[model samples]
Target: MAVPAPRTVRTVAAALSAALAATLLATATATATAPARAERQHRRPPHTWTVTEAAHAPGARIALDDTTGALSLAVSRDGRTVIEPSPLGILAQQADLSQGLRFLHRKDRAVDERYRAKSGKRLDRRVRMNETRLSFATAAGARLDLVVRAAADGIAYRYVLPAGYGDVLGETSAFNLPSDAGAWLSTYRVDNEGRFNQYTAATAPTGEYSDQALFATDGGYTLLAESDLTGTYSGARLAHTQGTGTYRVELADSRVHTDGSLTTPWRAMITGDLATVTGSTFTDDLAPASKVADTSWIRPGTALWTWLAGGRTAGQSLGAQEAYVDYAAAHHWPYEAVDSGWYFKKDEWDVTDPDWRTDSWMPQLVDYARAKGVGIIVWIHQRDLDTPEERAEWLPTLERWGVKGVKIDFMNSEAQSMFQWYDTVLAQTAAHHLMVDFHGATLPKGIQRTWPQVMSMEAVGAEEKRTNTAAHLTTLPFTRNVIGSMDFTPGGFQRVGLRPNSDAAEAGLTVAYESGLQMFAGTPESYDQRPLARDFLDQEPAAWDDTRLLAGSPGQEAVLARRSGERWFLGGVYAGAAHTATVPLAVGRGRWLVQTIRDGADGLAQDSQVLHGGDDLRIDVVADGGFAGIACPWHPGVTTCYR
Candidate 1:
């Protein structure tokens, strides 16, 4: 073989020698010097070469620089500066895959459009996608890639590491924002035990992690979020960077195991009008395709939760749960959730205890509920799901005993270990064809697209906390529920909101919130006391075919319209003062029966009218109250045209 030229050999030798000397120097100073250690730990190796690969969509473009591995995204239709070329890289134990990496070849492809989630807050998201991959060789000779995608919704990027084992040290790249942009950051815990905190980007506290960070610009909004997280990765947080409005990604835990090759969760930056941003369905689009062979068993419906009624029961025991099941049966609910303390081992909630609590109560209740056509879902603590044996042993037993699902609770952290464990819970439960609902858990990130059996996650600071306000209820559709299913337990019709005269927010919540399994949290007997309230609960569903935002903003009034099958449900909520607005309908041709219920002098007022498609119906919501009801055409097929 022919040898390389002298100049080329000299260049290679110089690079290798420099890299070797720097490594040696870093190791030499690792012993005693703190500054030296910090420098070695934080310093990024410099890159000497550069090239850019870019792809454009209808209104957006994403460009990746091979030189510094920075990704710059632009939403150009509005002529606004979305992101001004942000550095994108990773830090790992074995290699600083950040900067100072040699560029390799790249490949580009486009994802063909397809439709899923037929309708919800959107008609159907046509998956228009353009993807590019830039390969690199780190200074330590490790291989990695920056995979970028430009879609109709926004731009997404992820790091692709070769099959290996090590801790993912951190991020080398950050999202730099314009100085004028304001942020809407949230500190609401997915767990039921926390308070809600919302603030702007610049004033956001350092070191705290927010599930969703929204930056509002003059032209539109910019969203920084993550999705499709699996067992290989931990939950990620958007942290405030030192710069005026810069933010960076921080993994709850960076230690990762790439079964062979690993693809990090998508680092997404979505931009557009409130409607565009709110209606975009990229969270589901970016997730892995479903792995289940038979998803027919997966069902979505309303259920009754027993835990929140502890205040009513005062004493927790088997009789209280049976009473809830009786109401579920009477109301025609599809399921009932038997909350924690159903077993002897209250601390660890995995399975049956032969000696202490394997009483006939659970079996009798399960059989009774099943006989009544209502399924049973039991609540279990997360601690019991610590191992494969634990999962393997209990889930099958529950399945054999006719338990339909499990509300897995107490996942207090979003660390990498929790991510793996969460995956195990879903997979194990799915293997037995059982559904799941997560409580005391991290905000769910698009995993439901892969596992629809995961009905809902309790991530919103909702009614269950008893601190929910009209503002909180109104803000959810635009923030928390906009990204994923929110288990905002409703139906305590007697009271509502965090302020006075708030009783009217209940019906609005039942109609506004989106979840696969809607579990009403108050005593079932309390609901049965009022026929109108019980009737509304019986007529409602958990998930919908289509959803549309009608009015308001965060912490303000909200009017939303949803479609299930062919029927339409609309609801609105407001606080501080009385509200009235003319609502536009997107329903197609022909007239329909519009039955509505709003706040009344004493309880609730109900009215009915014939409404034609494209009608602008004006509604008056009194102070501290809301509205909710249905609109269905007398003639179904002819009136159900696309809007």
Candidate 2:
């Protein structure tokens, strides 16, 4: 069973009231209950002494040295060290006070909290954890508390600040692996849509906003990211903490002020083997529980976006959008996101474009989609709603027209001011019952928990990556996705890369990636040209009940398996090595008729087989090619291969 979830304010207040009333009624006629003075005095909270500083993940420990005050990590392979010494430090604007911080008191305890996740690779219906908290104070009247949580899967920690704890500047929390460590780090962009680049830890770019840091040591692989965001605080990025030979947490701005108590987000580090790194759930682990009162409207499914499908299809305007609607209705996709130029004349940014504000056919389009059992969502530039009045002028009209959602785009920065505006937009859209998708935005930071209506964000280099390759495809499942929901909008069923195979390769992304809204980036007409490939695309799902990293690694190749309801779907890609692909069936124990799709005999043809799932299954993969299809409980007369 899932633990209690976060709810709207009123619901929380009501629950508290009911509990208070129950307590009053039960004790109203009874004598006051009290413990003996001696017993009461003796019952104090648990304490830990001589634990001035420490770091621990299950079955591992890195204690802080008293003389040096360096809190660092070390990776060892069977007693062979793979990392040089490094440290984690808390820094503030006041230098003397920063040095004054030291062990003043300590408390530790075991903890287990279970909660349901709204959506992710893993359901996490129940979360069990053990925590240790240490408190430190400076002579300058400022104090900082570190809360560390050790779970079987990963380790997470954060700083807790009491009221008037002095203004914190930032932290030195980067994983300082050996200088020679292999790494996969995304470019540091304010837009955060940069592609993953392979390099050494020493050569990884700094002085920018790279939300997560991932690297490989001879000891093991480690992935780092932040979670459980505190709204008032500015978001974080990475920068060279000069002379330390490591990147450090750089708060977005110098205006990190607090009037009352404030807690920083958890900086989580998931360290282990390849499977452990790829399968880690530390990011979502630190996310706050779902808080929406009624989440039925926040549905997950595939979508069709016109911008990705060549804005105007076959020289048809309204016909193009109608075709998109028809495609959704035919394939069971729930929504269609009609991108820019819907209201404008191809490239007009004016809000009052004659075709838009006055006589745009958006209302008629919405009505047409409704008749076809499809919901229509439109896009807008963030500048159009720079003020409340501007938003009021159109948000109501769109809602009245039965528009299902809106995609706000071109928010290319992560300044504190932009952060404030983001909160405003989320609240405003929810008030008007408008689901939202953020495009060209900052990396997600737990706002989805507070606002479930946020479907997905385009903080990743997806189909827009004109230079995309298999290396990029294989790396994303471990980096960009580890932080939050991404609008990959995958599926380009053609040989558009540095390889001969395309259909099967691109098709694999359906299972390789997860998003609340999985919008495909291809024309319906183009996909329809390839019927079998089109059928395969039609069956892909956006969310899953469970996810497994089946085989392969970052950059070279990868295979992923995801489950939805009773059926299972698997997708895998082999960049340049054509070989036998091994798939592990971790689902229910039964005879499953796996109608598989694999690279053709010559790497151009598509082949299929009906295999029984009693043990691991292997399929032929062509060099620079891939495969993806589905499996279900064996039934009569299922087709093994497509004609």
Candidate 3:
């Protein structure tokens, strides 16, 4: 949808004056002699919201207070109620409240305009205030209450969804401003079409504003944030998550004075909370009926095969199959992926033909991989299915074929229609009991909590593309990875050629940085040649029961530690330059085994080595450089096992 033009300061002032006059006139008519008394009695009422239905209610209220804004909302079976900080002065001043009104002009652009129209008409002008309220309901008689309040500097919103909705659908809160106001603006859309659902839609007038969108999923809740139009793709944006029993989106009014692509400022956080809410929380709340053999399906530790290497004939290559099986068997890795070309054409292959059954070598290869204890994950493109019926038709067949999961790729990111598609795909995929990995998509929020089968996703470009740099990889762990698992296909066979000082060390560090399902991106030949790195890949976890953001900040240094069984894996990355940080050893107790990789002091080479154990180790590393260490209890039973 198109963004409306921003009104001029003069126009905004005039509108405010008009609105205030109307409010004053109404107030005078209601109470001519008691104006002062009424004004004095306008204090906030006590929180009276209560849960009326027992089974449907989550029975919670969320309150937030920040320098820029404050918000309060309640959740119950009946519905949600919200009260935001209203700009009382503006309402009392503006003359024509709708004078500066703007909306998306109907046009055929991204999708057919006819199919993309708003489901509801423009809300009554009376309800249009600086403070806003939104309510959502589920078929189970549960409801959500959203209250938005404006602060001196910005705005904030809070809400709680009923417990039995299974998962949140999608949410978007847009502002309709004046059409003629001359201002620079832009648009952004983020969606994880392949994994746990993450999608966003935003618009600005000139398409020149900077934007940043973030999604975080913790526990059983999701948080999303969107910053206002800025000039560059960098800035601080407020975010709220379900772990905190709230979702907040904030926009800052700023000017564009630099040269760069217009990026949106949006943040999303997802988590689950049975008690009080907290930010950056992760929870798992998979439906009881939908839970699979968690041990059998959710294996901890790496995969040897990816679709990129096999190229056009990936699906039908016996050599690739043998290579993958060999790598898995030799390394003790549990999984392998049959990327995009498996079911359909490699470049322009179609799924309709029977190449796999007759002409190609897939039948033998699939059987071979199974024999070697390697589970296969196939690749499916979002565009492959035109509608929900087609998805329904194919998913069941995949499940029957014993396909462990599907990697869906190349989804339209920024449209409302596609948002619905994202939600539908997750719902349908769950029905078939198949795992999912999203590629070429937006960042993940917290879908994993509600649907644990969504293993990982690829939003940021990883080692597979060849263009990604050590700096880019470093930025992800702190920024994107903070939200959840990223399918940054690591472990490329090709050595680092761009920076001589950095070799395979960056790749190794990246693998450790990503605590999600690990996909090794290099060819089987490359891995076989390097036994040491190959050994590390073999022991990597497929999924983590818990993830701890030990230390770091967005676009800076990041240290993440994840546990599976009795092992604790830690990875730290720094972007562009060198830095020092002290990280705590909290994964377990007693003695442990530690392996590390850090930049060499000579400044021209990265030192690759291992260390057995140290209670607390001091680490000093250079830019575009970091370290990876795995701490396993020196003796069994000394540390708590994640398994």
Candidate 4:
């Protein structure tokens, strides 16, 4: 299906204005006596305006204090407040819209639509929200519109500067949590590779935090994140207002200057239980539709990465790459990523050299892999392709070599310029029909939605960090991976000292972590030791038709069920101590032959059983271990199934 064009607020506002004018004549008699009221409207506009989702379960109420001219927002779900009254305002170059504001008009409408995604947790998305646009004039007469969208799962709002208004300076937006609320936050970093530590609202350090801050409250869980980040504005972080339980907005750049008008990214509050937040699509919903008109070429699948196990310089030779390619082909994997040492010395930046690939062996490996029905993904340092001229020269060369994708590494920044650079690179890759995986990068904020060719990004502290505890792995689905695809480089079966998770647990991450380009970070010999686990990875599909967080708790345990075609893959990981639990088979009304891969007394174990919907399947997860299984429809003759 052709991707739908985005709807602009101006067009919607014009239509709404015309409708309001037509109704004005009918209420003339009632409005005639309000002339005195109209005169004082600037000083005392509506005190409060609220918009609720279709279900009326989640809503956002904007309160304006006529006396102080301060605007605040409160959010609620299931009759419980998720966010208290929090400040809301935007600072602009022409005028400060943070204070002394007068409401001019308000227009509201219901939005409901569905679109197809190239790859994600789910392929088809149904986005429904209640939208309201509130226009306000600063004391200096600068016009600004606050557009709020209330979805059944969350609330999102963004600042829109009209054509006449100047550029933006900053914002005073904040998420005020309850005093007793506990948060799981990552320290702010340019590479966004910080551990998510737990802290009380009052005791949490007063410093910069990453894109998302997960708060656990009496009401439910709320993931604070931003979406639809474009080149017009800078990336954002949260700074704790020391001991006050409020986290204020912090922009990466001081000022933002754009063309005619500018629209800030949406500040989203995804409120629900762990399941709701894990399965929410608020991030993708807020981004623009796919820019790649022909998404048929985009394929999501697993790749065999040699760098993690081979120590960065492995697989540089054609013979060495051919072995990895052979492994991928034998296992039905789609691609093999030759990382870090293909065209340059260690820690070198030779990508832009005129004779960069003069003595290259990559073309031979690429052709050989193509013959074996496998694709090659080469890694390039960010510094080499930082310029448009460099990218223009290299991107087409990669295509000519039959390279399916590029794993660009070491970006380590999220300023406004870097964000624009990301967009430009994605567009260039799309033009050449090349896929991209961003490493050493910022956390994803709906970039996959805009550029479907962007398969995944390395925003979490994954395998390369060498410190992934079960707690960190479990925390990911609710935090990092919740907002977008995460490339955690799972499937580390080798007994490396750095890897602490059990073999079964390591295998489970391949399913637990949702990355379009799921890179298995293990040597071929290591993976061959456990056929059950290796077979599971080979059969699993990276993209899914449906996903459900069957059970989860941050830093503890997470169990997910993903469906592709007619098969359902279930995976779970547990932290700290060993535990056992009964996972219900909620794949809907059908008898299924479930194949289980789990931790056993000696090592990995496999079992098969026939079960009906609602039946309980008990799993014995070892300490810091996990389990996984695939469920398929029961057939009369076939006793087992593998996809």
Candidate 5:
């Protein structure tokens, strides 16, 4: 015989059928008992049911109150409390689903899923978790389901509403933190390009707007973010009260009307050690599966972009674009981005030039690029291709001209309509066999999983603006880049206005930052000036088979080692004073050839050495400096590990 689940209520139909029979039997038995004993039963408290596996793990755990219909969650690591009991529920237009409700039924199961990523931090992923679905009915007789998943890394939960629920006003989900926890958070921006500042839990900012918030508890670290967003719901932000260690969810729109069934995105709490914080795939794992049937045409690689070097002046002509294409072909980079000013006017959104004489340059350049084994990614303002009609008008023409990708710019919003537009554009791009890179866009939320052709998105304060500091750069790996691909446009040697990083850090960003379409941000002449740095850029890979956080932390230093094949690449960035960083070579057990580039007195320095696995490679770095290296399997008398 099978064992019954503990703390589970009977289904509504079964309970209703048994109620009259049980009441009659109880009436007959009460005649033989004392009336005082029966009256005392009304004073008992509501039942609190726990959700955990057969052998309870020491990670995140969940619970629900049967009578009150309130849900709360907590997290622990190595027997220390990381997250306290936090409130979670929904507020529907029909009824207040948070209180005055009754339990209906409960279901629990195990989930073990495996899939291959087209482009991301890791190529192969396994998402294993224990799931619980708890059903409840509100006072107004409205039904809702609270779904929770407990993974090895952390926990995630979301709301599922049936049809006829007119509107969802908001969510009552909040992250309650400890009093001593330290936090790193970014103020809300439409483009999600804000600096992350550190604060204590009590002193954290109080506002209606915020991006992802990271916290360091006594036990470990935790990051609060959301994923699997669609057009039905607007993106959310954190609502905080001053001096309180609690933050609640506030939607961008005041209310979202839903006529059909709806499933909100997963509210994820990724918690663990420093390595877990940096290496966790919890966010993307919560996304929906891929919608594209054929993904062979989607290739992830580096691109040469000229906008950072000289703005529109450098990429405005056919000769300048050809130079970029030549440089890309020389370095084995797969793509070259042709930015704005390719059309009739620099600022207008016109790509349909019927006049062949004025538009003849595009096809000529496309043919030249195709002959050189390079793909051209043309830039278009987001307004030009946001709708189905607009995309149907130009996408096929660009396809006919043999353009492989499109760089859509200036989205700058996370409203529900923009979310729908993102889906429409990505689906259309995939149908036409083209890749996409979003600029001036909101932070990535695992849309890449559903649409593998979304190569990258520029949601960070990239090099094109030149306002990012070393500390800001160091903070991204643990925060923004943790969720999905961030196109920061690394590898610029020369500095312009307000840029304060060294040449060594520029090289380091190329490896530390992970993006499917990594843009090399320098003119061809600049790379010619520093050939060794160019050599390192040529050796780096855009996507990884595996990744590890070897050393350092957020806002101090970040040392990462990522693997592509049998070889491993290491990148490190440091802030504040100059120092030597000790990085352990955890590649594997064998003799390996190592080529390194670091900070010198004048510019970037380079060296080559041979060492065994588990040996430390220490490099001296200057203030706000960085270092990068490649390690390959080595035998006796080997001159080069990579061509």
Candidate 6:
């Protein structure tokens, strides 16, 4: 039987009441439920103590040498283990425990031979005593330790960073045990890079792309490494290979078991001091506290930009500004985006030089946009801010222009150094009170939780380039979007003429599934060509206040529902072939005005049909398919609730 859905929160007071109750219960119960084992565990000598009893069902216990900061974690079950040695520390180990052996970090045959015996035998090793330091308890009441050691092969040496690198630093080992393990491992890393591209040849184990083999679990628990980037590696350079030396390694010998529940803790890496290395080569700077902000603005039915109606050159010539203003005035679209070439010279690739001043017409454009109710977002290039001075100068100017957000393109990914750069950009943009959209970047790493103003990013190949397939769109939400919001410029009016299977409606389906800040890619003239399609565009929401995952997973199919005020908007896409899904209307119960956009049986339908809420709705959809449903409260006296 399916689990009953949780009740929806209609008001802030109700949410606060629930939070207060939960906090009180936790405070009251924490003092009464002290474990005798915990007391005994705490009593052991700091240096010699190791966790013997499992804290939760599937837990890891750490033992650090008092004299030496050498550390080791005993996993109750084997899976992937990530150990952060110390602050400013080298990677200690990353290995799969299911095989019951320490996996080789690199597969360079020549490098591996030097570390192994003549008989190809492995070696056992111990930490050098003189290079170790161990201490327990700090002002923060966290542990600290380190170990300077060489791998068994001796060719690769490492210095482990001490624990307590952050306010709270610990290790995590996630694996499925033979039985039910209630909890999961709690290890996470901060993503320095913006998006995940392909593995570079220099970084790849072989001279070709190599897929990291992870043991699949049937009923077992699995540990998924989270990142903040996206895109295909078919022809791109492998950016990940640069950090192979510093990648996390695990050492273990067994597969973990689970009770058919996904038990993995979401992790966030905390770095510090951005201003010190604003444009420096040192990429280890921590994310500033200011970057983290509240995202409660996301409620049930908020609207984000799906496209800018008048910013494109074609739109300008055809009076797109007037069209968009009229559309917003008549229909109630919240935001619009001003795409590339506005800040720089039109049709020119150079991003740094502001051609807007010389091109007096640009200010008129921005002014005209503001005159309308729509918000304006501009495009930017990261390559322009090659130096700190440039970043300081350009960012402030963007804010002065009264721009709502800036989209940064062509970021450098791969290597720990670039990771620091990624955080720096996000921090600097936030300081200016401007939203950010990262293109050619890696996946999101919970930065949204810290900086809610980071409106959206473009890690995936969105609709702008006119190359993304329906299948690509279907798979993204479950995988990339699970991390955070994406700026997949949806609502493209231009259709690429590919094969018969490649059609514009398929593109529309892709847009429907994306649940982030939306942008339109075609000209206003092109959009107006199809009246029905234009109507759908007019009614679409640009931002979402709250988001919910209704069903599906990465690279397969998924459904998402976003809330803005009392209205609920939902969209679903299927990536693998064709499939059908049923979504529950828990939040849609009170009353709703339903709007749906789906691929018709003939596969050419663009506009969606509207329906009033009466009985609960049931929808049947096909593969490479799309569906959007909007629900609003029903009113007796009001004739039209929409507006």
TM-score of 5: 0.90
Q: Top model by lDDT, which number?
A: 4
- Model 1 C-alpha lDDT per residue in residues 274-389, reported as the tens digit of each score: 66676667777777766666788888889987777562343245566677777788888899888777764443333355544344366777888888899988888888777888
lDDT of 4: 0.85
Worst 10 residues of 1 by lDDT: 49-58
In order of lDDT, best first, we have 4, 5, 1, 2, 3, 6
Q: Which of candidates 1 and 6 reaches a greater lDDT?
A: 1
Q: Give the runs in model 5 whose Cα sits over 4 Å from its true position.
A: 1-46, 49-58, 65-68, 346-353, 356-360
- Root-mean-square deviation of each candidate, in angstroms? 10.0, 15.6, 17.5, 11.3, 7.7, 21.5
Q: Taking the tens digit of each residue's C-alpha lDDT, what string does model 3 give over 41-83?
A: 5543422322211333223333322221222333222232121
Q: lDDT per residue, candidate 2, 1-643, as tens digits?
A: 2344545666889999999999988676344433554465455422322211123333324445444344554433434433444445566554323234567665777655565555567555455566667676665666767777766555667777776545566666655667777778776777788778787777765545376767777667767677765545677787753234366667776656556776777877666677766766666666776656676766777888777577644322567788888888988778888887676554323445554655667778899999988888888899987688978976888888888889899988766667778877777787777888888887766556667787778888787677776687778887777666788777765435522346677777767777777777777776776666677777876777877777767787777778887778888876667788777765567667676666564433444454556467777777766788777776678654222
Residue 464 alpha-carbon offset, candidate 1, angstroms: 2.2
User: What ranges in model 2 sit over 4 Å off?
Assistant: 1-65, 68-86, 93-98, 109-111, 165-167, 203-209, 240-245, 312-317, 345-358, 494-501, 601-614, 635-643
The list of candidate 3 runs beyond 4 A from truth reads 1-279, 282-301, 308-316, 344-360, 414-416, 465-471, 493-495, 498-516, 528-530, 578-581, 599-615, 635-643
Q: Select the stronger candidate by lDDT from 1 and 4.
A: 4
lDDT of 6 at 619: 59
* TM-score attained by model 3: 0.58
Candidate 3, run of 10 with poorest lDDT: 116-125
How would you encode candidate 5's per-residue C-alpha lDDT over 1-643 as one tens digit per residue? 2344332345665777799889998998888675766666544555455544334333555565554657777777667777788887777777676666677888988988898887778999998888888787877788888888877676788989888877888888888888679888887888878777778777876775455788899768888888898888889888777798888888887788686888998988787787887887887788888999999999999888868755467577777788888989999888888887686554223446566434557778889999999898888899989767878877987888888899899998888888888878888899999899999887777788888898888888777665677888888888888888888888777663456577777788888889999988887888888887898888877889998887867888888888999888888888889888888887889998988888777677887888889898888888888888888999877877567
Runs in model 6 with CA error above 4 Å? 1-216, 219-331, 343-359, 464-471, 496-516, 525-533, 540-545, 576-581, 586-593, 601-617, 634-641
